[model samples]
Target: MQQTAERPSTAASSSLEIKANPITGQERVLTEGACALLQALCQEFAAEVDTLLARRKQRQQSIDAGALPDFLPDTQSIRDSDWKIRGIPKDLLDRRVEITGPVDRKMIINALNAGVKVFMADFEDSLAPSWEKLIQGQVNLQDAVRGEIEYTAPETGKHYQLCDDPAVLVARVRGLHLPEEHLLFNGKPIPGCLFDFSMYFFHNYRQLLAKGSGPYFYIPKLESHLEARWWAKVFAFVEERLCLQPGTIKCTCLIETLPAVFEMDEILYELRSNIVALNCGRWDYIFSYIKTLKNHADRVLPDRQQVGMDKPFLSAYSRLLIKTCHKRGALAMGGMAAFIPAKDPEVNAKVLERVRADKELEARNGHDGTWIAHPGLAQIALEIFDDYIGKERPNQLHITRDVDAPILAAELLAPCDGSRTEEGMRLNIRIALQYIEAWIGGNGCVPIYGLMEDAATAEISRTSIWQWIRHGKSLSNGKLVTKELFCNMLTEELAAVKKEVGEQRFTHGRFIQAASLLEEITTADELVDFLTLPGYRLLTA
Candidate 1:
């Protein structure tokens, strides 16, 4: 089996590859005078960076040196007469675990009744931003957990309906990146103090546990195994202080970052038995891809509609995740297929059809279950997963268990020339473009010429590709690809696609689209055909 954690870094090296800074790419040209002044100021007042770095280093060292609390409760010690998480029932394993939209509590209840093992009452990205909406969401969750929720208005200012029903599994709280105090909309922060929101979240977990409920969570922005380790340590601290059990606080991390994909095994290893599931997060994943490839100017942001699901890195990453999780007997969940529909009935129908088609693809590709944001599309996710499960065989793809394909390819194509090089921008594009070419030619797996390769190698390549694509640039480039060349290319392309994406532009969907288009240009006739696709025009910026 592949190691679940990263091996320690080998002994240090001397010379390192140097590349131009990313911040200087466009900013220097656009605001040369101001940029120079700012650089001067930074040189004079750079102590803050050192201070922040020192603090972070200290925090990590403290965590590493800290011992597991003696009061840490055993997760297995908790006994619930009504529910259990010891072992996934065989019947449940054979069936699908579905997540429904938060708008319709009725649909969620219905899905739970239908034997779904988890129901995430999403509050983060799915729910629109607002203080009132958030507080109301908490109340709704509390009521739902107690089975005292009411669908009918009680004439006054409340609604109450009593029942003895139990929630299949409840995920509460939201805003993973932003804390409650930082909650803002349209550049305005929402004001409402909960004394200490962190304490509130922790205390809520304690209360839920005391009520014989499992302490479950959906951890987002899991960037690295270290981040995962931090969450584990934090959970340990809370559990100890609250007099709760260790393994009782189960969590399913949302794979939402480039580094997280590469560090999946390590993150899982760190979380261990506390990890209940893993979901492929799409929107943020796409955003991260843009950030990853931000180095290449030619790979401008693509139109949202142009970003296809058939991209090479996404498929490989998704497959790698499923393989890793399944091999360890853990649930590998397909990430959310955001089924946003238009107000027009005709447009809505088209949207629903697209969602159904995508769900079908996910089911056929090896996803055990998927997410749906709209209640109207709840039946679509359920029905599609059910159909696949009933067939009695998992989706088998062109990509096999050989996991070293992409990693070895990456190493060969973008080898570590060993100078601590900072030329990731160019190398990432070249490698990604090449990967796409191979993928389009029915060569789904990366082929490493004249090098040792294995499943672990392939998984790392997929993970690395996804990470590079996430940011629209690689971390190194001198020995890989230079930042100046990338910035020049981006400057040229940005003039064309800026209008399509509009103002407040930060994503790089346009870039992915361009690369996808260029990859199809093996022949002149094929180039025309590729241009006809929506992505060609969208990729200009």
Candidate 2:
């Protein structure tokens, strides 16, 4: 149920009066040796950063003057691109936090009151873009991030006031050429969009930093590792010019693009200096997957409702990410659970249950946190985390050695390829059939090869089936599905999957095998045995 608090108290009112000052040129404090070194560093690498900024500024000036630059560079960098990346080498797996309430006030309250370490003040995807609305949003975000309460919300048809709170509000700006997620200005994908946004953010950052505010940012839709490196370079310039610490600013990247996912490891390495955490970006990533792999026309954006968190690829990705983040000593947070369904209480209840289950699994599996989109959902989400984290953890189960994770990942992801080879198609079928068998039989709670599986884990198995069905539905002529027809289809598809997986010179087969083992297990006891078996990490003591 949605929990609404009583009206704002005097304390809430009192928190709003804090304001930050705008200060300039504090870099003169460096000692002679430090100053000389800093100057030398600037002279050596400043040109690269400066050139990028100058070009960006030039493009912005042209845009304001109603002109387009003669040439626009390709925004995407593929495997073949000769792009050189440089920056702080760090991974932001789960070091930070996310604040995603529907209302700004609610978001601020959750961050300030919940004891969460970081809070991203989202204005791009979360805020609707009406001209007046955007200005009001910008002011609200600026005030929130600045920890100031005196700013007025630009007057809208409805009267809303800004709140004074000492929350760490890291602003999320719109990205360049991102048309689907946000608006596109003029015909050209808003020239200097990122630069201008950064400048505005820097404007507020300088103001707040001078008042002893912390440095924070939530960078979204970062497609390339170069983007991470570029942002680092830009931050370095700002900090250097401001006479701040070398890595004063903190950031979290949203790996929403397929390319971003491919280079996630690299991006994590690049943003090391100030990188904090990462999200399992749901919507944008789904959208990107469809756009990238054009052949599978049938598997177009699945209804978001139909695409549950249990789907194999996403489930594995989520689990893998959590493990990856924790291994690196960073936090691994679960992805966003959208607003509690307003119209259907049943659906809302189910959503809450799934969210709770996911939180339990994440904490059990090793995650620092998760995100929700409403104030009403926040307390429950936190409670769920509390219950599982730092408590009696069940022993972690290990997958059977025979189950090849790389092969499993390949099989789960096979449906997306829609390739010409028979082996690719065969592997996709094998994975889907395995999913249907597990879901229909309630195999989630059963043991498979001595490993325990649960409902949440079961869903991953089911989703793989769904992904495959989506592919077959698209490939075949409106054919009615029968059990035999489905089984035959899978038999053929599994072969293709095997052939393709075999050819992928690079392999992470063990992870795929582990997924296969989880696909079959249904009970916690079984999981204990599975983990205790040779060659696996036991999550539970």
Candidate 3:
């Protein structure tokens, strides 16, 4: 069913070179026209992507050498200037609840039908970037855009189809740092996000326009306003190439990295013409906190669970984000709620209540919208937002949140208060290992221990443990977290995991490889920037 082939020459993409497995059922998505468009995107922007990535390393080296990330002095004028982003599209105004998941067909159908105001078809943290899955995800989104997306239970014969009114569809492309080695132009690898954006926009922009929607995006892991400028340029290039309006491609940037938090105002200024919102990417932000402060022993975090949104640093971050975005006429979106309704009545009630309290805090805090992993929590989020935002107002941009106390670097970087525990350490190892195993095995979003786990959460787990070891943080049980101790715990934890998942599945999955990779990352001389990068290489192995 698979065969190798060379693509036909196109005027625009004659220099494109792609080494990929046959796109079995996805040949139509990668036609000559689409490939040409992708080549153009790579040719115009891929070099800038490399330069930006190198800058990222330079900045990290500064952080590694005792330079705490702070606001850019040269760009202080942008932060202080009076400006507001361009008008938001009508469809994106009331994003009270948004569901995010990998761009698989069944998942896409369900998420779009989920009663949320928006559904983000994720090609980033929630997706395993195998070459086949990448192209197939493009094919799936094309079908969904045309309203021809469907899925049937191969075993039970039940069918699934789209509802007449589906939530607004948006795509979250992979971060700029990720590269698509399978596809290249002029001997340079394509940035993964550009590849995703180009393919989907090329294949479905016209159809989306006819349906009264445009190509919406959620940009992730941005470290500075300059990175945001890069995205703006790419969006502008696309709009010009297609002869569309300037703001046709609307985006929401995630203020996840510590460096990004310092430049919120500057980032919004850069994307003023095309961005509508700023999302608090809570999980990755936690990972970034550990990574950015890896050299500061005084800033080692407590248990991962203990570092909730209520922490002084995080609370300051949220309050600051809300104030900054509101000041610039942009929506301040909240982070994801990881809980799911359990089958047991009492347990599910507690889960719902926890999610409610979380959403209620965000709603009361003036965030215009929040994220949920499952549809079951949509009603809860909707009710909380409705109670706080009311029916007359579409959003809370009117509430500038200026009354809140000023947030400074001291508040944002203050060390959190809590105790580390051996139990939490074991849980982190299990979570990181299993998630990495599933990720490299071609599954990114997975359910482990009854919760939906993605690369973001896994990053938190991985980096937390590494930071713990690097600082020789001691657990509540009086044992110092050292390399030898970590290896011992890893061995025991691997056995416990093997026993939990059973021998059959353990034999078939990549648990051993995952454990090896986890140990390598957590014990390395320097913290691994991202576990997924090494995991991506394992896909070839």
Model 3 Cα lDDT, one tens digit per residue, 284-398: 9999999999999989998888998999899999999999999999999999998777999999998898898889989988999999999888999999999999978788899
- Looking at model 2, residue 177 earns an lDDT score of 34
Candidate 1 lDDT for residue 125: 41
Taking the tens digit of each residue's C-alpha lDDT, what string does model 2 give over 1-541?
A: 1112322222123111111121122111122333333333334443444454455445444533544222113432332243322232232222223445322453454455444434556545543222223344455555555555342345644433333433355566555432211112221212223422443454566676676554666677666666678777767776776688776777667765544654555565567666655567655555444434423444443333345456665666566555444333334556765545344677767767876776676556555666655445666666766665533431121211223243233422433322222333333344433333332322212223212222222333333334434444432344433334445654454444446447452142332343344333321222211111211111100
CA lDDT, every prediction?
0.44, 0.44, 0.89
Model 3 quality (TM-score): 0.97
Better of 1 and 3 by TM-score: 3
* lDDT by residue (tens digit), candidate 1, 74-186: 32122111221234323225324455444234444543444444566655443332333444555555556656556654376544343344334545334223323222222
Predictions ranked by TM-score, top down?
A: 3, 2, 1
TM-score of each: 0.52, 0.52, 0.97
Give candidate 2 regions above 4 Å deviation. 1-97, 101-118, 128-131, 150-166, 179-196, 206-213, 297-303, 341-348, 391-412, 416-541
